[model samples]
Target: MPLKACKMFSNPTSAPKAPSRYCQKTLHLLENFKTLVVMGDEPDREILKMVARTTIRTKLYEALADQLTDIVVNSVLCIRKPEEAIDLFMVEIMHMRHKFDVEGLVLDHGSRHPDMKRRAENCFILTCNVSLEYEKRIFLLKCRAEGGNGCSLKASGR
Candidate 1:
């Protein structure tokens, strides 16, 4: 369940056959997963470094993305910084958005990348924490609540 094993990657038009030992190991790790893999080619080396750093720190993201297929089938992926790396993740989602059932996204705080907001129009943008989780739960409840077209979210016991 390492970041390298998450299989998050980008597909270049003409990638070198024999990549570096590190890239090769990362690629092999990524191929073993079934979730959406997000990556780009321009910053291949940087991304590799990030993955290495993440593996050294913790494998939470990789593990979550790997087993996230069980949560909502489709997902609402939120990448902290998606400026130059936006397209990499976008392309991956575009390819599988139809095959799977990606509902939307909630880009939380700490993302200073400007383009992230503009480019991420494809998904929802959630800026608040409490509101974000509340909205997510409401969305799920709405999905499950049959004939719930005009449901209200006012505070209870008002």
Candidate 2:
């Protein structure tokens, strides 16, 4: 048995006009098996760069605003910080969930793991992080904030 796959580029103008010979051959070979084709907008370099600096929680909320039912936010409290603030926040969140009859609570942990995938099958788990390739961006921002040139900071490996 053979399957043929057909992909429809949402933006026809963005689709490559002529694929390479290797691509044509691969497509020809796959013409007899079941194939699933997914189409999406090409990644934007500027958006990708911005995402690298943004936190996972902010990105998830922005992307899934309509679908999100409940969210649990965690914060660290020191002795100088008011414990009642966190308690009140949790109480308010619980009240909101109860009033709205929220369906699911998504936990954003900022990193991925094997257990995360398993837990995601049962509940929503958000895993997103600033990739190592973008570490330079963070460093540059810190350097700028400290009134130092980013290039010099990178050269010094600080």
Candidate 3:
């Protein structure tokens, strides 16, 4: 069988559905992580959260049950080359809470253009790197502690 077919058989749970703009990419990311997770064995809590947020948001969008992801995607895509600060993004996402749930967010911090770096840095300053394991856990706990906390599940569609 072909590699893609083999993978589909091996990891049916993470397979992407057709007519999905993100399905194939999501499954590919999961497969790549599956390999990396076992070697060196350090869990990238941030990345896992990123994937989860991406998956959930994408599904939420495709399902059209909520417009949260659509708003975030629009805002981020609208930002020029670099990007705006995380808080700005969060605020934008927060504004759409009436349309969807914002339970937890995972900001992507990979290096890129100056604008991208600025965006990530701003996120760090805003959330104090809450996407990081320890801080992220605290953020989750605090959200749960509160009744209607809006968490930004940050992830780049790239």
Candidate 4:
């Protein structure tokens, strides 16, 4: 008499694709991304509306698309930091918009600087915490060196 034994193994590489009914070629898995979702006072259904059709409801938040997690927001901060304030309370500094990247510099409460038009087609923007006069002095010197008109010949404050 003889006894037979066999072992079976499954392939890890052949794992099931996500959203089986959806696209199998491009699985929008967040395996490599670092994400954080901040729950505001809004109900899940309301928040879900802001989410894009391409994103899974269980996954990333709309503002946090492209790994730009706006962070796990606190309710009061959410009230204070929405894109637009209620008609009663309007303040620029506290109102954060989803249009811009969180890591990018916002520059002076988003107020327009001097020598800039209400609508500019092409322009350069420079920002610093120092006094505008200091920046003006630097700009004046550079402009003079480049033979550009309308700039002071000297650097202020020796």
Q: What TM-score, over all chains together, does every model reach?
A: 0.15, 0.18, 0.19, 0.17
**Which digits, one per residue and each the tens of the lDDT, describe model 3 over residues 1-158?**
34455454553455454324354566677777674432123334445444445665544443442334444444443432443322443443223325554444434454455555433433543334334221112222223446675555433332
Best by TM-score: 3
Off by over 4 Å in 2: 1-19, 35-105, 109-129, 132-158
Look at candidate 3 and give me any clashing residue pairs.
82-115, 82-116, 105-152, 105-153, 106-154
Which model is ahead, 1 or 3, in terms of lDDT? 3
Ranking of models by TM-score: 3, 2, 4, 1
TM-score of candidate 1 to 2 decimals: 0.15
What would the C-alpha RMSD of candidate 3 be, to one decimal place?
A: 20.9
Scored by lDDT, model 3 comes in at: 0.43
Deviation from native of the Cα of residue 29 in model 1, angstroms: 0.5
Q: 68-137 in candidate 2: lDDT tens per residue?
A: 3122222112111332322324332222333443334534344566564534455665656654332323
Deviating ranges (above 4 Å) for candidate 3 = 1-35, 39-42, 62-158
Report the Cα RMSD per candidate.
21.9, 21.9, 20.9, 22.8
The residue-by-residue lDDT of candidate 4 on 99-152, one tens digit each, is 764533244555566776788777776765653321223423535446456555
* Prediction 4 global C-alpha lDDT: 0.40
* Cα lDDT listed for each candidate: 0.42, 0.38, 0.43, 0.40
